[model samples]
Target: MADEPKTPVPESPPAPAVAKKAAAAKPAATAAAAGNDAKLAGRTTTAAARRPKKAPADDDTSPLMGRRGWMGLAWGAFTAANAGCLAATGRFMFPNVLNEPPQQFTVGFPDDYGIGVDERFKDTQGVWIVRTESDYTHEAPGFYALFSICTHLGCTPNWLSAENKFKCPCHGSGFRPTGINFEGPAPRPLERTRIALAEDGQILVDKGQKFQEELGGWADQDSFLQT
Candidate 1:
């Protein structure tokens, strides 16, 4: 019984097959681990790149302040407005200061107001009415009326019956009773109002419509009055 040659048994082919399968499985596991690691790195990078944000603060943006500044603006506007009002008032009141007070009003009932020829009446800041008996020519026995003020400085004028003229006490300005400025600073004759006859048989005169120193065109109607 010599040691028969222990047969060198042939290695099983199944062993190599098993080893190849395990090697393939190892590669898959390694690839999966690498993929997981890459994903984790991406997340870390993204988080690190982000920056923190800031919050808004409340700020005061108001215009209320400084009482003195506002007061100055108000005062300036008020003064300008006051000046404008005064100027406007002057425009309306100027006539009163520069012109004579309407007086010596005439109510033209030539017969009632008619006196003698060249008959003069003192018209000192008053209204007068005249009526004539005869149909005097525009210049004759007809009655005339006028404001008794010195046309120059608005002084009340007095009529002198004997002289048949007007005299202003303020400045010696003189005028013929017929309303002519003969010697005076007056630029023209006394003012005259619009005169007319009322249906009631009385003469009507409008003192408010005092015409300029010139004889009104209607003043020529003195020939038509009946007292």
Candidate 2:
């Protein structure tokens, strides 16, 4: 018998059926692959969580002791102290100006005094106010101020009413009621200060401007003011 006739096997299913089965198998495979990827990602996340964390580093920065911070503070303090010292020195060197009384002062009215020597200003002003007659007849009267300072050593001479003269307690210098040095080491007569009348009817005495009989200053019209 010759080779049995090869029975042609039934033809495989159509390509469409095969394609459909393949498509169905592809979905299951893709599901399995996605599950495996999800598991791997979960494992990686667990490993990261199990790792030990690193310790924090120590901080070395200081707030006040920084390089320029402290240095700038010290410099500022030094400059402020120096400035205060300079200001104090300047104030001491050139102090504030003051207005003091002048050498000329008011001694009140002429009628306030008596006829003879007025010793009211002796201890206070170092001067004596004397109202005397120009002549022995006692007709023409004039007023004069006699400096109480002794001519010998610039000491104050006390008026001795008992002795009728002015006597120095320091050098024994004596002066008459008219301010004439009669005894002791006094070289000249006592000096007289300038006198003037103020607009307010007060007697103005200028102690800075004095008249000395030895220097012919008594002839000056400013030596005394006419009442």
lDDT scores in order: 0.60, 0.81
* Candidate 1 TM-score, C-alpha based: 0.42
Residue pairs with colliding backbones in model 2 are none
CA RMSD per model (angstroms): 21.2, 21.4
Q: Tens digit of lDDT per residue, candidate 2, span 1-227?
A: 67877878888898999999999999999999999888787365766789999888535488646667777999999999999999988888886888755667778898887667788877777788877766122235666788888999898888888898899999999988778889999999899888888899988778898888889787677776665
lDDT of 1 by residue, 79-100 (tens): 9999999999889976655666
Say which candidate scores most in TM-score: 2
lDDT of 2 at 210: 87
Local error of candidate 2 at residue 213 (angstroms) = 0.6
Q: What is the TM-score of each candidate against the true structure?
A: 0.42, 0.57
- lDDT score at residue 37, model 2, on the 0-100 scale: 88
Worst 10 residues of 1 by lDDT: 116-125
